[model samples]
Target: MDTYITNKIMAVITTASNVSPGGAPVFKCQSKDDLYSITANLEAILDGIAHALNDEIYIIVKH
Candidate 1:
């Protein structure tokens, strides 16, 4: 099987102000891919959920 990788961020979802030990949300996963790929990844990442996964999701491009 072939794999596609283009710099990704390891994301985590939480449901509390302070995530204690053994209480951290699962790692969702983020990326620094192209616009189309980024949107598609975000869409799939946030699918079927009715709550804000995190405080914010951002990226910084160094160029």
Candidate 2:
């Protein structure tokens, strides 16, 4: 079987100001619409899945 990345976080999208920088890229959006839009685009571009941790946070992950 071919090996591939699994259960890895590709990016972080959030509107919260307190979300400090860390592992994976973080995208801060001004509005909910922008957040959702960026998250969707990142998901598609990264070939990952978008999982909303909350109303203001979204994480793109690969599995």
Query: Each prediction's Cα lDDT score?
Result: 0.36, 0.93
lDDT of 2 at 12: 95
Show model 1 residue runs off by greater than 4 Å: 1-33, 48-63
Q: What is the lDDT of residue 27 in candidate 2?
A: 94
- Tell me the RMSD of model 1 versus the true structure: 12.1
- Worst 10 contiguous positions by lDDT, candidate 2: 17-26
TM-score of every model versus the real structure: 0.24, 0.90
How many clashing pairs does model 2 include?
0
Local accuracy of candidate 2 as per-residue lDDT tens digits, 18-57 = 8976988899999999998999899999999999899988
State residue 52's C-alpha deviation in candidate 1, in Å: 20
Q: Any runs in candidate 2 off by more than 4 Å, and if so which?
A: 1-3
| Candidate 1 global CA lDDT score | 0.36
